[model samples]
Target chain A: MDGNKILVLDDVSVRYRKQDSRSTSDIVKRILGKSPRNNEFWALKNVSFSLERGDMLGVIGKNGAGKSTMMKAISGTLTPASGTIEKTGKICALLELGTGFDREMTVKENVYLRGAFMGYSKEFIDSKYDEIIDFAEMREFQNSPFRTLSSGMKSRIAFAIASMIEPDIIILDEIFAVGDGDFRKKSQQKMQSIIDNGDTTALMVSHSLQSVRAQCNKVLWLDKGRMVMFGDPNTVCDAYAEYLNTGKLPQTESLAATQENPRNRLKKNTGKRLAEAAVYLMLLLVIIAGCFVWSQYDLLKSYVLAQSLTVEQIENEAANYHRQIDRLLEVDTTRWDTGIFKEGALDIINEEATYTDVAKEVLLQAGDLSRDQYKKALAAAEIEAIKYSHMARLDALVAQMRTEFEAQPEGKYRSLMVYAYTNCDRFYDLEEDCENDMQKVIEEIRTFQRKAGQSEDLADRVWNAYKSEKTYLLSYYCVKLR
Target chain B: MTSDKANHRFLLSELIRRDFIKKYKRTTFGILWSALSPLFLLLTMDVVFGTFFGRNMPHYTIYLFCGLLLFNYFSAATRSAMRVLYDNAQIYSKVPVPKHYFLISQSVAQAIDFAVSLLVFFIFVAIDGINFHWRFLYLLFPMVCLYFINFGIGMFLSTLYIFFRDINYLWPVVTRIIMYASAIFYDPSILPGIMRRLLNCNPLYMCVDYFRQLIIHSTVPSLSTHLIMIVMAAICALLGWFTYHITRDKIALYV
Candidate 1:
């Protein structure tokens, strides 16, 4: 935490909860009083390091080995689940390419935007704009939208904006990977210039061992999130490069390897033993209940069959009706009217119907029915046809009604009232049995009126129909009686 | 520190101006696209909504655009801010400056667009022979306040995004939800009491409401109410700045 020591990490460790490899249903069952297995994974463990001002530290690690996590912890993006970090200085970081450039904005604007993001003001950006653009080598198309720029171009722009703003300590996260050969050379030069300035301390994360050797004075080797080796660039790089060549520790093992003592190993082993014991017990329980589970399967199978049968019945009846209509249309063109096709056809196709009676009818007329039906009635084809025709007819009727309603609004309202009155008349004809149905029609019309919020004249038209149509009136009374 | 702030400010202006020009560099109409994009969007929204929500809407497009222009600036700026840290992660990774500048830059860029769109709005109003009112200048008060509010939101989100990339996907849904909930297209007065209250809670509502009052109603909104709104904006900006300061170091890693 001293001024000279720009960054320090003491025994930093990161752990993430690992999900159990169980189905969602299994998890739900566990939630409902059933016990679930537990698992945890450590991404970083017992990592310790320090960096001083003027020292260029290069962090090298394999992908997913917690290099990024460690960087994140140091950067303050991630709080280490354990351990402590003390730092001093204004830290600047270049974590990714084009981290702040607005693609829709020009290079100049993106620079300003980047500057502002770094807490700079508009006037400040104005002064440095040209220099930043010049460094990026994008002056020719600085006014072009960033989206129009190539990936390499975007990277250069981002790099230029970042490097232009001088900070006490700068962090670069694999930005050297961006751009072409020429631009890469320029980027390298720019990085060297920053380092040469002497006031800025830097941390660079890269996979390029050569770059680390050339540019960095202090090197940190991170293996699976732990500091494997640290200190002089040549020594750390040699050890790291050797470790890569052979999947083993260096011949002269670094202190980090021996730092994991027997006590820690015992603790880790005990944790593993506990987890294994729990898994064994669960496996034993499964084996003990294997017989009971088999017996219960029969009951569950029956229940599933019962539910599936209901669905099958509906599907069969719809198909049968659809076939009947298709046959009728094929045989007698005069009997079928295309104009009657409407929008509720699909809904009708999906309706449930008692298919036992239809099956009996089909069996009785096996000899007289078409060859197609005789061959496929038992195979579900007949049922499918019936469903299709019924749906098509319903759809046509709905479509016709909608068209008429739109074409003649007043007449449509009159017709609705007349229908309601007819239902009312039927109340008496059916000995008050139709009362409920009549009342439902009146209620539906009232609901429509409420929802319409139309002018009084429109409401009057509907009301007049209700008054004049005797059936509608009788149906309304019948409904009241019910 | 003062010199640093000045240097940063100069750099920010250049970025914003570049951002503005870059938006239309390739198009045939070029800069005119700035004026036309909003116009096209306004007209399309008007026609589409006019068929369903036309009644009670006097000059529906104008009314909608008034609120839209202001809201668009806020929305676009905040949306860009969501990615500001990640987009400029390169710069932050290498340079050290206060992170709020990026949020401000995005807001400023949007302000420029808002300015261009405002001109288009007024031109249409004049051509339509809409009455002129001196009170229209009062609209600037809310607009300026709204700019700060956007900056605050941008700072908070950009910092949050660095930690949770998921914030990126969630942001658009949140914006859309707020858009409909706010009085961007409809009059807040027509909404139910509960809904109206809820709408008032939206910070953008105050800005949009003020814009409508000044431009359409030709009257000044309650000064105290606006002052309260400005205070709210200031609080948001402060909170955003604090959050960025606290989380600024972490952004490079998370991004």
Candidate 2:
């Protein structure tokens, strides 16, 4: 909390849940109020560290030793599950080399973008842009996309951008592992200059103990998410070196054991979470309500329109609508059912005579009629069915003219209208018989329409039903009065 | 929280700029695809359904374009935004930049594409012989609302995606359903009564329908349209933000 302290951490602990082990079924089970097995591990546990102005601290740890996690916690990317981290000023983090640089964008563009990621303003980046390019020695390929650059070149650019930004704290993670020896020496000099500025604090996580001993004044050693040592650079570095060699800590009092227990120190209050849960519940309810209102939006619009209209206006609209319908009804039109059978009857009438004769003999046997009587009845039935088909076609043409005045009706209505009017003129030139086969055709169509309606599969059902009926009607007598 | 005011503004512009560049990267026609792709879709859909519905509906092409523009924007923007967190895990998990900035930038980039497509839409409108009117400017209202809605949904989806990769597979199916329900290529007026009402519930349809009302019918949108849009935008944005705020801290670990 002191003025010189640029960054401070008090008992910061970060827990990471392994999400890969969770399955979709587990999610459903959890939603059903059954808790799944926990798969959480502490990435950083009760980590407390502080850095003052001009302090150069080096963090040393083995793989999976919570080095990156601690840096992330400091940079503000990953919030600690339990603990408080207080920082005095902006943090410029280079956690990964070329972290925010777009591979497709030019190196120059990446500088500005990466600088922005570090929380630097455009004008500020612009002012420092030339210095950064010169420092990274990327002037020749600055216009080229970042991906075209070598790994060392990318790291230099990343390092140059972070070093040029004059933030209160700068976090660098393994940036020195890349680039040539020349670049390393140059970057080391840059770090020295930053420390010499006496106004900025730096935290570097590195595996190079030599660099930590040479450049950093303070050192912190970590092992498995727990801080093992924090002291002068040489002392901790020696201890870390010996530990790495022997896989054993120095015979010194344990820092982790001396620190206060994390559980008792961490807040256990559930009130805030309970309130959040209630708010989430309310949000879900409101969302559902909103959906209901949205679903009724059409109704809402009509109600609004109705409200805006006077009684006389409503009456006038209603009268106008009725008048239109009356005009449509006045024109003599074919029934919706009559037009359907006409099309079916025409197909059968157009078939080859030989095929029909064979079908007629089969139908005669199936019908149990005397052969001579069957032949005569089949001829009469054929003429009557053909005549009815012609009359139905004539009725259709009249209906087309009636529906023409109405606005474009779509879906079933339009199909009905179209079916009625289609090819009606073609039947006009043909000879006609006055006798009607209305009773049989009407019965078949009603059956088809009923099948279509009940199944809610109108088009397919109608077509399938008509196909089966077409086979029986092929012989004319087969469809006779049944 | 690390980003101050100036930094936040610069970061947003940069992020938007990156998204815009990435969208057309390596493509031959590049940004023109924004206009050409939708125009191509419009032509195909017009040919397929134009004779069926076009004969009865005046300026049917314009009506279809209005729906296509809004629906495509909503679909593309939200879908891309769904993966923003996962895609940019390299940056956000390392740096402390605000996570929602990426979502905002993505939605804005898609909004830019919508704007370009809008220009193409107007060209078709003129070719179809419909006169332009001042009321068309009111389209800004729905466009802005739609941007928020897309951003909000993107935020919500991206959050879910970080925790559950299955969302990557599930979202397209949902968007497909939304595409059908939106009635983008077809006229809602022709749909059955109950169906039309349900379609109204789809926010994408509402935005598309408003565009048609203004561009094709030349009728001013009613107060209810504006109210519904604003309400939808607010609810979605707030809900998205709430979910995001709740899970943002955990996102780094998950990603």
Candidate 3:
């Protein structure tokens, strides 16, 4: 590792696809689906530079010279299409004025939010929060939404936040362009302080040749994405200044003497390879985990369902079973015969209907059954018991009611009807009984009405009850007869 | 490195807070809008769908509310997520923070809004005479599943939006179709089995139906239903993350 070098760009280049051309021919071509002719070009090409810790590099270039692109590449915003960039430590960037802030948020919230964006913990921000606000000289405006601040105020806060955090690297892209004179002096002092610390690297892109010449230890000059010179600040800045004033390109020979440093160049491709591997690994993990979860979904669902519902519904009837369910969740699910576990959970739910000693014995024997046959036998036993209970009660009630109705043939009477809707199929034990009982009751009521001949009013009452209940049971009933 | 992770978590919460504050800024109703907005929407839907053809069905308002609530949250979260990259271009374009953080933050803000509306929904359920059951707590499962699915869809849509402005017009129409197909107003149970199965394939419909199962019918959705939800959430999240990851390099330039 090059201990002194904190940032390295080895033959870095970035390409941008040109915005869709608006010409009539292009539109027609697009509409015709000919893939709108590839219009991408390199914005930055083969730009190699390295920054030692605490080295402040000034980048000077004319408009469209890819200066900002290089800053973005260095700041970790834009990825290089064809080369590698290796940098260590966090970067604090002021790519543009008011660029990274939510304008509608209060100034304080934006500061914390941005601080979080830069990977500073809230406790750290809380400690430095007052100092940041004070340095920006916006104590009163801190509570006001960020958009309400003037441009100068915005720049001040932006600079204060960027500078205050003490980042390992700072990228300033024409940040000095907007602020007032006093604020500029303050920010320059702050930059000087950062540089004097002798460990924080800084990259500033500026059109102001004077400040670049004064503040930067090294300078890079670019023209149309090609590096013109990279070396001592005076030599490169003077060449750039002359190019601007006289419209003459610097001499190649003169610039060759100040070529990029050899010692700082990165010698390994490990960083890029590692990043690529991590992403692929993540993709693999997502796929594997997905399949694993999918295959085990029944087990997972059983475990989660049992655990969640057991807390609320099964506490009183099957309190002892709670520990079993809890242990089912805690133990390794991969080893589970989920068929048995699921059946066991369903049987526990049917613990409510396990009134008879025979059913209780069957429930007790559930643990001994073969895993495959367990679900079916346990479910059948639970269902049969539940059916016997509900059906026997209904049959007895109907038999007694028939005798009473026959004796009171001339009297007006109100009959109570119970509708047992078998709508809850999830309750495995109750569904069959409810469905059979519902059909039987409906048939029995029809026959009784046919025999009573004078039961027209009773027919209307039963129809009303059916209409109000809407096909499912568990509703009020008003069966009347005369 | 630990501090960085902690800060990223802090960043997520702060960004969510910022989105929440921005959403309510200068509005008179403020947080109250979270509850009242859904109610107002429910009232309009009730007037249109409930009174006209739904009088015979018990608790039709609650049924409609259940569908509308989930759909609105899904649409709002995803719609906001689609714009997250473009809207916060100033932030992530310059900073080194993960772009999905902003997407998650915006989506979470919408979730908090949905949570408030859910409380109101429960109140409505009580008023409609639907008994609250132990299964109602199972809502957290679907809510979590819906969030991941929405986050996944948001990632997919936001990437599309960066490359194609056509999606700006296309997405609302897609959301409308999702709303109609999700059986938000009408019950899917009345539909033919194949049609209902096709509709249930939509993850949004599954989430809506989960709510109906818990709140309207007071039953835990079948374990298979739970499986579908988990599978859907996982697949959508993976697909969204994969697309976002693959295209992330190209995004900054286009945005």
Candidate 4:
């Protein structure tokens, strides 16, 4: 318990009660003195050691071997289930990466925060602020939020603050793993410098064998939570390294060498090669499938669009012709003897009758008509209307078709465009109407551009195609719509 | 020996200030948070429980605040002490100072926060234009009594925490249970006969009642009961000191 001794742990044992395979209710019953099956895990058993002034002790062990548990006990982060620990000086422990740092605070503020947590006054921290920053090499980032710092930078700052407090005993738990190679080396050197000051006793936990050999004067080897070896650095480290190599004590180099046989190396290489090949094959398959899916989507879209447009055009023309026939018949009953009707009554009546029959036939044939049949019907109606001086009715029908074209469902119109683009035969037959429709679309887009205060060049390709061959204009509209 | 003790006391004071400042260093509210905690608690508890318990009581917020402020100091101090050793296990492990210093510092820190909170309560009382009596000066008696009571409990629990880590989880439950048991938000006189007798046995309730009587009601607590409270507080202090002295060496081993 004397100040000269610095730190001592005698016969430390930490045991955790393993839970029963039974339910919690069963465990409660067992607590009332009923028998229940259970197991026990000893995190540390019969661990004993002493640390002297200026001593640098490195603790090394495999995962779950209780190295951390021992550090916790020494640092007073955890109480031993059984044992005694005595210390004679102020102790500071850095058990986590950036443990006391508040991410919302600036680097300067976090330095003071950590200082305060270690029980240092604000004045003390202020005096040491520059030294802390210099050690962390983050002078430029002093006002930056801790959350903005890289992990390596944060660890460096944390280490700087922890070390600047000048405690008699400094306990570090695996903090060396932070930072890049250069920063890690610098940090290691700084730690070594602290130990070299001879006023501080350092207890470090690290898995790096090289670090232990370089920095520690004494080595403590923990195995399954028990102190297996405690002695000079070279002897303990040698034994520990041997244990790692051969999974046993008294290891021989020749045995270790022979254990690393070429056959195993070859097997590992082959496994790696196979894994690489599998990854490459997976990547190649993904690319091929992606291209196939994209092309298939394009084809499907074109087919549906072409079909929808042809159907919409045929339906609109038939509807217009039917409406005209209805008007003509209404006149025959209501206004047949009027003066305007007397002038062109017979001719108009004949044309109306012809259109009525054509509309009914077109409506009937609409379901079976391919793209070609619909275009032919449109052309035949245009020629007949021209001969009978019913060109106005044909223009009305064209106007009706244009309105229907714009109002068609987005999916149906898109599929119709894809259909027109994919089939060159039907595309040519519908070229003139498609060209006119494209011109109308370009005009509509230009009007939208003017209203939206955008450039006329927005739809130049469509206007240019309309001015060129009609087939090209049709193809352009089909592609653009899709 | 006295100089060494003075140095230790100085260290304890430094730790108290550090603890208080650390809590609000990066916070924009800063020291205002210390005052805000109790003020918020007083307002909430007054609104919630005052409607039912405050019909007969005059200036209920003031009455509730007076008692609540004192009780809050006690609860905060003891709760913090219950975890003080565990929270600062690192310091205890390496430092050769008396373990009671940490507990004392924690109580002192809470006392400072309570003082700030008291100022806020006074502002409210002033705004409400409550009449003051010269006997209000005696309010210090109960305040000192509460402080000692909290200090004694803090010392006891800080030592206990080194041995039992489960004390950390048990503290909040104990605090909530004692909150209703004490005369924090309501007058204890409203309790039924047997329950009132039981409440009388509570040290915190007696201390708070004394404050209410002296400050709000403008009367001294019965001399006999005051004497009993002083004796009880002395006994707790002695017990706490004895427990700490006996267990001080073992804390570093345990924690």
Candidate 5:
């Protein structure tokens, strides 16, 4: 390791054990004095490279060519099975964007979160919030929840936050490949500016050889875990292109191995290989556990609030019942989200934030359209009935009730009869209390009785039946005089 | 290097803030839910277990809440920590901070929530006619101890979860088992001698039992209990810290 070099890799290699020992029986057998054969694959080998201050090296390799493994080692995320890596500087990498973003948090909140993960202070982030938002063109949407934004918008926000660091060494993995044409140009210019500042060294991995050739001072090429070439961008990329084109090595002289680049004689760690090899998922009961909790602020609040409000018979019960059936909704969904009018459970739905209202509906309905249709018709009819009085109200209410009664065989007319009785009782009670307008009330009752589809002699027939039975349930005052 | 430490602390606080906000965002009741959730659990447990233990236990709800408060902090902290690496994989793979920061941030956030919920617990204490003695202040010792244990358990679980994702599913069940074993509801005195002895082995139970000794019994636990709590905490912290250090670099690869 040279003192002036920002990073030095002396024949670093990473090895992954094969899948033989992953089986429990195999592991058990191995534990019981049975030695397992060597089964391993080297993902990277002898990948020696060095960088000085302000040096930009572009890494190019095909899939499974050890490019990502090298990046992981350089970023200090993955340890090498053999060889050694030494670096001297504050380093940061952008291997992925929006990695830790909480889907429910706002863009501004995500900025702080991403910054925290990047190890930046809040004061520094606070100072740069405007610049970050401005760069992403997300000034208006800074407060919107991250899940609400488009995937493209999310990447832009992530990029803006990741680009704010001014560390001595920066590692980037396919960050410029995000966003649209305009955004791509904007970020590319930003990357160019960061490089031009002259103090930071960078190692970039890209499939775009044209970009690497244009931007990098030197390029490193790899093919199937071997370092094919490490030299000027034109020479290395041309050689890589020729190799890909012809399926053979380009006849070019290799970079002379300097005194610093020795045949790295680091010890291989066979013990560490065991743990990483058995990393495949355990053969255990895979419970659908993510089902337990949801964004419960709404659910819990709704639970407490739902308890305090007075029950409005069917309407409140329907809301409560809807919320109750859903395991998650049982905890959340307040009246604000679920706009239920008291007369009979008519929901004035807000299309944008309907889930806060509709999630319970799903839990209760669960793609059952018959119940939904009945509910919609019932609610609409109830609202219509309550909007009018006497004749018109009874006519419409009975029509709706009959339709609802006919649709479902289970409830029959039981539910409708109860509602109708309640309505009749309410109307009669109104007629009795309105002593000042007895004539008008009586006329209204007569009109409603006709609206019920009764003939003109119905009152006479009812009087005769009452006389025959010797029953005088209705007094002269209680009866509507014709 | 001074800026580096400052940076870590600042990052820690920001993570805590994010955890807090993400949990309660768009929630109607916000932080009040944190306090109210325990009260809700206490009521359910009291009703279900009330007939069995209510008559025998003095101030049954208060006793239940004391144990619940501590166990809940552990559950919340570890649950939060459990998902820190996997959930944050998108960022964790990119950013180069030490992996333990994620777990530490979760613990701190849960600690803040636990602290807030305690305020609500005090409200109940007042309503239940529980007297405010100077000894109530002694509850701070167990509270601090509980926080450390929570952080330690969280770190350990987070590391295990990175390697074996089944641990995520296993966690809630484990916490429930701990809660039941911790004597959160029924009295341990009702158990057989062997089982009661085993309760001493569970760090979670020991912490909860000590906390109850402070808040409910209104006295310091005997020196042995104190020593047990301290030793268990140290062991958990050391184990968790060691696990984290060993597995820290490997976590990125798994993600």
Candidate 6:
């Protein structure tokens, strides 16, 4: 928990599952939680270590001893299935020499290009440009293609450029093996200086026991993916060398033994994961809810806008529509004036006027008419026809009464008037309408009053008097016949 | 999380440059194919649909181009984004930069392709004598919205691709369905009422519809339509980011 401990590996174990081994169906089943883990192997088993600031830790192991895997986990390229790897500073994993070199590019270009892969800015590489060339002793060949260089030259330049990266924690994988002997010594001195500075910490993998003992104050030795020793470099490297010579793993304190029980640790890790999942789930809910609220806001806004009018307002609007129709009717009255009923006019017979022509002439005369005016005209015409029919019936009844009076002159004049009035009422009351069965008797009366060469005063006098006493005169005619 | 955002911004330019270089490396066409392919697709779509399948399609070329460019950008961005972890495992394993830098960088590269294809599309508009009205200026709005939406989907799918890997193959079919549902060749109005309504809910379709509403229809989208697009982009971005962060730690393992 102090500032001194720059890196801590608390019983870290990395498991590598055979990713491509399972069939598609098996993978689906496994994903669906219908099956268990398949073809998974733990590469590191409860390995634990810690390094303080300015600490130099050398890792010594045979091939496949989980050394590379531990380095990868430290650099965060591999995720551990269990345990934890925590570092408190900037970590620069110095991978293989010339890891990203473009063979077609010059050595100088490779420096910039490789620097980018190492996550260094162009300006940083620019600042460190000269120093790298001097260290690698490739100043003369800096402009030459990287492919043209000798293998030694390439490795020297790559190592020189990579080592210029000044970070808090440095990860070295067989880095000391770069360059020839003198260059190796110079690079080892640089490594020692980086460690001597209180600001830097290093974890390195090396095959050389002598070099590890010479350069590193502490060493970790591994055998078949198990840590054999972790202590003073001289002691551990001596033990490691002894084991190599004797072909046996020496009995030593297990570095992972002091760690907490893994079940308790699993519980802790699971608790942390559950908390993370809870946070993510809560965030997800908030997002979904926010999305819903946004859409609903839009929906609600449009809904409210579309449904803005109330039922009472709609009823009021219907009333307003009726008022508008009346106003429109008032605006242009002639457009609705065409007569639809012409049956009353069709029954009229005249020597000069055909019924159809009479109807057409009446229609022509009903100019600039409205609906009410047309209806009134049709009713008047119908009344005139009824009056004419009644006039004819009155004449027939009067004639019959006169024939009876000849047989008996004093017979009932009341009977004659009653029959004449009852039968002739249609002609007397000349109210016009559609579909009536008589012609206009007023026209015939007017024609009789307006006979040729008659004086104007006499015509006017007879027209008025005739309307007043026509029924009286008819009853008198019946009495005279008697 | 804030530090991750800063990391991406710090290396943003470099990341984009690296992505562009990586995408077109060693190819004679370089990045020109980004524009060229959409042009070719537009031609093929115009010929096939304008002459035959969609004979009733009004301005079929531009209609198909709108969908093609936007969807193509989405496909390109997501395809590259899907491989961000697996393809650049070397750099990621060496450094501790944020994974989102990869997504943004890839999306920017796709945006360039989108811009190029769009330029070609506008030229066709001029050739066809479609009025390049002031409304066309609003196409920028939808274009910006589409890029972000595409970024969001890329982040979502690429994150899932790390876990499942099968999503890589499934994605093509998924995009094809989206394209069909988007009314890329045929007008969305030609779709059944329910289908059109459902298509309105599609974020890709929403973006396309927004563009068409502005440019093709020469009308601003409704307030709700604009809201849906903005919300869709915002929500997708939110989900994409958190999905990435939540699954980010497991990316190396799963890949």
Q: Judged by DockQ, which candidate is best?
A: 2
The C-alpha lDDT values of all candidates are: 0.65, 0.73, 0.73, 0.66, 0.66, 0.67
lDDT of 6 by residue, A49-137 (tens): 89998888899988888888888888876667678888885677766655545565678866776555455666677899999999999
My TM-score estimates for the predictions, one after another, are 0.50, 0.73, 0.69, 0.53, 0.65, 0.69
Ranking according to DockQ, highest score first: 2, 3, 5, 6, 1, 4
Candidate 2 colliding pairs: none
Instruction: Give the per-residue lDDT digits (tens) of candidate 1, residues B1-255.
Output: 345656565766665665566556667997677688888888888888777666766767678887778777778888877787777665554444445555677778778877888899999777756788877888788878888888888888888877666678889999899788877777665654446546665778878787777777677876545755766676667656656765553454455
Writing each residue's lDDT as its tens digit, candidate 4 over A219-293 gives 988876756688788888989988898898553332233221122222332355456656655554564465455
How does candidate 6 fare on TM-score? 0.69
* Model no. 5, DockQ: 0.18
Q: What is candidate 2's fraction of native contacts?
A: 0.62
Better of 1 and 3 by DockQ: 3
Q: Which stretches of candidate 6 lie over 4 Å from their true place?
A: A18-21, A28-35, A82-84, A100-110, A113-119, A133-157, A177-199, A223-226, A245-277, A292-482, B1-10, B52-60, B126-137
Distance from true location, Cα of B147 in model 5, Å: 2.0
lDDT of 5 by residue, A159-179 (tens): 787666566788888777778
lDDT of 1 by residue, A1-482 (tens): 57688788777776554652445575578789676444445677777778877879898988877776776567655555566778775566676676545556666666765666555656656788888889888899987777788888878887887688776667788888778999889888988988988878888899999989998999888776566788898998888788889888654344344343212432442355456656655544554365345334434443443345565764654456565655554553232222222112322344532343333233332212333442333233333434445434434544565566577776444455445443433543555555455555556556555766733343344344444543333333323322
- RMSD in Å for candidate 6, one decimal? 19.7
- Please list the residue runs of candidate 5 whose C-alpha ends up more than 4 Å from where it truly belongs after superposition: A1-3, A16-26, A29-40, A96-100, A250-482
What's each prediction's clash count? Answer: 84, 0, 0, 11, 4, 13
Which structure is stronger by lDDT: 2 or 6? Answer: 2
**TM-score, chain B only, every model?**
0.90, 0.95, 0.95, 0.91, 0.94, 0.91
lDDT of 1 at B40: 88
TM-score of chain A of each: 0.49, 0.58, 0.54, 0.48, 0.50, 0.56
For model 5 chain A, give the 10-residue run with minimal summed lDDT. Answer: A280-289
Ten-residue region with minimum lDDT total, candidate 4 chain B: B1-10
DockQ values for all predictions? 0.15, 0.34, 0.29, 0.01, 0.18, 0.17
Q: Count clashing residue pairs in model 1.
A: 84
